[model samples]
Target: MSHPIYLTKSDLKTARSCTTKLYYKKLGYPTVDRVDGYTRILADGNFIVSKIAHLLYPDGIYISANLKTEESLINAAQETIAYLQQDNVILFEPVLYHNHKLARADILVKQGDRTEIIEIRAKGFDSKAHEDLIRYRKLSYFRNKRTGKVGGEWRYIIEDVAYQVGILQEMLAQHLPDLQIEIAPYLLVPDRAKTTSIDNLASYFQIQRLSTHRNSFSKFNGIAVNFTGDVQEIEKDQFLTKVSIETEVAELIEPTLTSAQKYLDYLIEQSSEIFAPISKGCKSCEYRASDRDDRDGFRQCWGDLADVEPHVLDLYQMGRIGGHETPLVNEMILQGKASMFDVPLEVLDDDTYSYRQLIQIEYTQKNKEWVSEQLPTILKQIEYPIHFIDFETSRMVIPYRAGMQTYEQVAFQWSCHTIAEPEAPAIQTEWLDLENTFPNFQFAESLMEVLGDRGTILTWATHENSVLRDIYYQMQVYGYHNPQLQTWLANTAKLGTKGKSNLVDMNALTLKHYFHPLMKGRTSLKCVLPAIWKTNPYLHEIPDFQQYYREVDGEILSPYDVLPQLQIGDRIQVVNEGAGAMLAYQDLMFGENRNLGIDNQAMRSQWEELLYQYCRLDTMAMVIIWKHWQKLCAEVL
Candidate 1:
């Protein structure tokens, strides 16, 4: 029952990141949460593919035995030696253990005493993969001597056979010279089509049933399954198709399964480092959940700590938190590098401060609470009833109209909860079910009627004003004449350009004014809503929000044939079916509306009430936050 003494992929990755992290991981440091579903799928897929590669060269020695431990690496190295001794072509997973360290080679191919190590990745060859393979080969070369084996050759194998060939070949040419191996042309293996008949036979065989708990489709009876055929047909159609290439490789080399098991046992004996946190290991380590305590402390002192740091500038790069950027502005204050005035109390207290504090100071101040409080004061100097309005619109890509960007916002449904009198509760009014044809114009007309001539119009985000302004401009381009449109334009233009005016973003507000313990980790409206109101907007039972969006977006039409019973005051207005199709389009452009309740009609009604309550609560949250900002402004300004 002794723990294995081998380095895992994660351990190697951690070693790359920082030796300290690796050291901590080896000492059994607590990590983070379990891998998400997508990552799990990838890990499983890689293991399956690796096994298939092993089947391709059957007589190959398995350097590592414990699929879960690092010692299997030695098994792989020993397998390579056996293959070389027999002058047999070998397919193997090689584990290189040297100086009490371990690493894995995805596939090792030995042809007549010449061996080449292959690293298999499910991803197509990319620059990152190129860099990783080079590093892996170097590690293998250094460790091969410790395991009493020669580092013969190296190759990087990836999934996209056609497209990645040139890329891989080029990288091999560039990096393999130092290792004294002339780079051969890279090989790409396209995904083999699983014939319908083979799939049926495989399913019928239910070979997986033998190891019910193990979902390995590659390994059967301690041998990799590379080829599939009826026992009678095997002699007639030996090479009909290389269905089980891995199994075929296994059969050719014909290493005893018992020997493979011994190598596996050795790997278990040698692998002793508790999954540690090396800098490189963080890139894709699954055992991070075990390092949660260290990560949390790092996150608190730094900003958002990540397991991996990207070498390139991309979305992935942004996930990394390291070096100078680790210590947040507030943390700088705690470290006595900045003064109190340099960081606001609200900034320090905000629940989303972890993320917001990452941005520069000035931009962070323009949030909901700040605008709401400042607006009332700014309007005190003028003589017009202040109007606070909120609007919901949908946009389309691929130009629903000519002369539009590939994606343009076409306002369809608007719910404006207006606050006219300063002391009065906001009155609610909304316009939905607009015909798709000329929705913008109709929306403009309705807007002008409610807005009147002289009031400071307010919205939650500057994007709202921009949406209106853009529609007005589009109307002019289309030669639609309206005097009110002109007025709306002049008024909005005086405020600012679209998305930069007297509008508010509640996201900004919460980041500035509030910091509930419940809101500690998230800033999205969905997260913020429940944190402030103790309820979720999407808690409904009818017309599942996903289906609603799907119907609206034209992914599919509403099932009118399966119409539910309509109760009193329930208005089921099926506007132009095509118009509603815009809903699905909107959903895709934004995101699936998870807030829609379930599919039952009675539950749908209850959900409708819940939606209303949620929306009302949103406005109420605005009000409460506004009051907090007013008090802070009075005290600070």
Candidate 2:
């Protein structure tokens, strides 16, 4: 069977990490359905900058298009060689091959006898780029077949050449075996400059002269080039200027396997070794779901590294243990000292209390002060005409409609509680209930009714506003005009300031404004809730709604049968019993739940009510937090 051709750096990285991931990639299964907005913007910026960098070498030939196929790549390389024979072509986006592996260079400068490779990176020069350049240089050297030849020279033209040289030198020392190479650094002509090279001129005094000389280029191997015109504007904006340099020695050889395939093989070979229970590589591993309970599997994979502190691994395990001990274990794990298995049972001398209880006691003692100080201030600023909103949405890979990039959030349900006045009773409002599969325009309209003419509409994050905007856009696209929805959106845009409806992110706020002892140095709502309020809504919440949805969708169980089996009372009991236990387990697994407090039954009851109340209080908390932040900003101004 023919092997799959995965040529990109991302593909190689994935293949090296997980064969299953590589297989999924080969099958055209998407690892990411859509890139984040910020990432998209960054990518676009990078492309634009890269194109501008190529304009530094205006006469450059574009040897290749961004091709996905191996055949296209080979054809491009042939074209690059052919173009090289004719003139001093500044080859843009050239695909070069070494040992059957392919790499695309942003700019390849063919000047007389010596070919200077110029690589353009969007980010400012950093150690990472230097390392990448070193690797690319090694690949180039090997592929270009210049290993045996001692006098061969290659030049690197980069954006920040001087800064990158140090990293390049270090890498070359480590990777290259006594190969004499000369590197000449070239700085880009600034936007205001007409002429380029400012070499050998005083940094302060040369500004005017450099600006004037920026457009003209010096003779290199008797060939003259111009550095002025915008490369992106040249040839209908098709080329980029980031080049990969290599020696001729590296070019002539052919490997039996492609870079992606070789990486995949490496992953499969090292699978057992890399999948260790240690948390070092666990944070981003694709195999995390499979290792949930596979202790032996963990031992086989990462047992040797068990002595090392497990961070995410400990957290994952603590989640499974369940209860008050969960936080305790989480704290211990976060401390980077002991794993749950290492904790001595004899340390918990209080026979009346379980080992879990001892851990909670320890955790509470550590983090209570921070939580106490911050919680009151966080709770004080909430005012009336408030809306408590929660959105249940799913992100799908692949843009479902035109003008939509990959991954759109489809809002399925929203639970809201509205209070008209601080003293008045709040009314519960909900939309798109899971109970009904049909479109609920009436539900949406009713929501709009309560949300009339606007007061502070509180949401946990900016997500609610996004969901509303998405729905509004969808409605407009489909020609379903509700004047009320449109008006609400327009008002929200004006007030929220760019679709960010007076929205507050509690997670971000907590990190910014508060800390908790029981929180065990973690800021997540799940962790914070138990620490501050002494209760967890998630604890013993049988068949969590999300999990239930997945199970139902998979046709593994009926919705009617699932909820009936998990009676609310039984679920509540599960929460009460499970809370302390998990917190205790967390203490053993991690170190201590820093936010836990002394077991005051009176305080516990109050805190329990507060925990449930706090879940309901989140939207209020967000509004309160936002108001406080605004006040703080005003005070600063």
Candidate 3:
């Protein structure tokens, strides 16, 4: 059967972002926005919140539909219509359709002449913190208060509900023609400004998967919530709050619905693709070239300009250097320039442009590596017992413990590679907690013990400083009386404060001094490591690093790409990134599989081991980079 073209609520959202993306989405063109580790955890969290939303109305009837299929949409719409016939009824996921556009509201309530639509989102909002951003009654956070423009970060969520309201209004107008119903729109989301009275509220709910795949956290269709507490207690605590966005919906519904209708018409009648104007935003488009066996939509849009080597987009700080109202690349595109060589050297002389950008352009054009003369002096100043550390934390929507607000950061794991002296072997020490308990204080205490008061503490970016500063505040709020920990925090994590900071940012050093054509104007550890590893063949010959040196299809892979994978039933899961670690933590703590009649201890051990190896590799990556830099400095001296 041929697939039907229905402009779904999700489609409306895509069209609003970029109409071209909607075209790519409908045609099943390969895109890079496929479900990944971070998104999977978010999906799992949203699924749990959805089930909790249903607990408030025990009498509500749930209308299930395979939202992917057109036949199911029709069947579900018919079912919802049957439910709507009652004078007073509450429905969950009620399907509404009109003019070939469809939407499934999170919660629908009908009471005599009153009707309400509530959309549940896993996204967090702090009412008190964001009060200034919200306009009174008119919108929650859909506009910039000063500019009165649609510029808020969470505008998409509000726009999504607006589209739903518009479609539902049309459906009612066509189906229940004579019914005079007053519709109210609301948003149900986690309010970080409010605290939960109940302890371990999030742990009470477990995510059980119906699918056989072990890493099926993202498969929301197969999830069943296993709650172990009274539903009434959750209602009393008001774990998630309902916020009315009636005015916000009213402000956007008309225009959103009209544009959606136009998009539907274009999809039906247009023979050629509707191309969005080329801009700097296209740099991050997911429809760009990938390794998949499908046509590249970005290539189709840019033609030969997309294939330009050392492309203008690859220039470091391209937009900031020109001091133009628009991005430099955008201005260049308008002037018919595409290659990095097209950018003139005279532009770098501007005061707005940093010397770093000049070095990038110069060395890249010369095809030569550039190391600063200050490298030897910088290397000489280093103290003994150097410490390289990496941390893994999660900012979950639902607080795992009580007395905490939603979306609070919980640092669960840390790994440190310490070198006591020059040429000494790297000693690895790690910590992890998988129990259903608070881990922030313990995480800080254990980390402090391993990193004593006599080494140069190193990290890739400012993330470590930010995380430590947050934990310092958390320690104060929790009334921890450890003077030494506080002193360590003040001395090491004084990132934005007036105090001296012992922490050294290696990434900053790279940005200031290092330049390699292989880096391609990117400084992320993941990007830099592979570039260095590929260029320096002697790294693979080292005994300690031989395990990561694997050739596949005559191509060498990064150490991160070689992390071990674990097999559970028919699924293989790996923990190389922060998102993967977050998922593993959730599974180990609150997943149904952990509590099933199986080898729970064995599963926990396996997850902990994977976490250990991944964290260890993270620190090891820093060690290798430092070693390469030291060798270069020695040769220059």
Candidate 4:
């Protein structure tokens, strides 16, 4: 059996992030967490963009056409060399191999003695805004920030391009000196500033997954790309330059190529399982997911390194405290002093919010939870008839309507739980639209209808505010004339114009006045809910919350953990997180959820019920959390 390709772009990025990841990744250890469908869709969307992007040149050769399997990468390299020998051929996914390392450039334009290297990325960057961010001191830069500047999240992307370029140049000098590698590394990203000439440009290319893999030339695994040009235009219009990668890498802002090569050389030298010291980056590590037999690679790696169950990496926002202006945690990591146990005593006592950080550390160490001293006083501000609203929405690559920009806001379903009084039955109302129609305006209208003029409209985070604000703009765009909507939206929604919002932010509320030991340091609703649910037994009896509580074999369960599975075509999909909900919406919208005549009405009914149950659980979760807070308040008051 041949060895799987270990050193790729992804591995290089991972190693750049933290050397430990390369070790774990190459070991074939499955991530404790599963990659969501939404992420998969996004990657494929980038793939589709690359395909259309190549059509812009219309001269690039696809070396990937026959290189389908692991074994085929070898053949692909040979094909790339053959194409390189030819006259000025544009190569899409141009294969470059150096020793065991391999790379496939998104687009390699080989023109006689000069070759241009282009990388197609889905990330968007406004050059003007980027410069502003740099000036505001909000962004830190390299030795030279003015010329060809790059900072913030683009650091990783720059490293990736640099690595690819370095590999190509080295390979060229050694293999094909005749091909003068005048490699001008450029990033072809979404030009948000440019408008597409064609209408519904996004919907033209439909991406469907095939159960079996297509040959190498296929766009992606299981995905069939059938593009229908101009969903709204009668004339054959193209968007080659109009929707091109508007933001190009500046000429002089390039980081040291030696820096990229150094990491690559180290990665090549390091064998499998290279253990690294803990760092702040471990907080968001994807490898945190456990594998077969409940073995967590993230925890195990950190545990062995620090010999502490909960380390400094778990400290809430450890890296953000000094802002981008300083690098305290980074300096510590460099000195091999980055760990929960190694956290400086002064570091925990310096900030205004240091009290909470100290409390978190204590509780984590003692294996207990901490509640704020002012929990009850803060909870007393609540009024009766609190409305808990939750929306499941999506921002698609393809616009649903003509003139709609890519990733236009679309709210598909919303659920609300009305608590008229302290003991009211916690009535539930919901609206879901999945038919072949835009649901944003209808969603807003239905939500407004359910929430009449009097009560504190509540939600877990600021996202709800942003959603309503987008809907307000959408209403104006669609020529929806309703003064009542304008009035209601202005008063309750976070208006971009007035910079005001009436909807109570529960996450902000939780952060200021509440902290459950179980919640660690994060304030997301899911984390907060689980942290409070099992602790309060009274909540387990409330009808709205009762269904979520059950002691099975002495183990407590979470409601979010037990949502039903959805049949999307032949595949069974579980709609659990926000990502899952988005994927589910896509499946339904694309007819993947519609079984062979599964009864139009019946299927719609099932979809409504499925969607409703998921959202109802969200609003109901708010109720349970509210009741739990009420109980905690009573204890303190």
- Report lDDT per candidate: 0.39, 0.41, 0.79, 0.66
Find the 10 residues in a row with the least total lDDT in model 2. Answer: 200-209
Tens-place lDDT digits, model 2, residues 335-356: 5544434443454444433433
Ranking by lDDT: 3, 4, 2, 1
Tens-digit lDDT track of model 3 for 180-293? 888899888888888877787777888877773331112246677788888878888756878877777788888888888888887877635455877666777788556764
Error of 2 at 522 (Å): 5.3
Worst 10 residues of 4 by lDDT: 238-247
Over the stretch 1-637, how does candidate 4's per-residue lDDT look in tens digits? Answer: 1254336666666766777777667665567455566786566557556656665666667665444455676677777777877767898777766654566788888787667777776665344454565588554322135544455576666656666666766676777886655667766665444334554355455566678874443335566565566333422332222211112333222443444345555555664435666656676777754435455667676555545445555577677655566646666656656456566657665566677677777777777545577767666667767899999998765456655555668898898999898778789999887654678888888999998878788899888899999988878876888888877887777776567787888888887777776787788878888777767677777666767776767767677876676664355645666776676666566534433274555555555566667788888888888877777677766
TM-score of every candidate relative to the true structure: 0.37, 0.37, 0.93, 0.83
Looking at model 3, which ten-residue stretch has the lowest summed lDDT?
A: 212-221
Candidate with more favorable, higher lDDT: 1 or 4: 4
Please give the distance, in angstroms, between residue 418's alpha carbon in candidate 3 and its true position after superposition.
0.7
> Which candidate leads in lDDT?
3
| Cα RMSD for candidates in order | 16.9, 20.6, 2.9, 4.8
Report, for all candidates in order, the number of backbone clashes. 66, 72, 0, 10
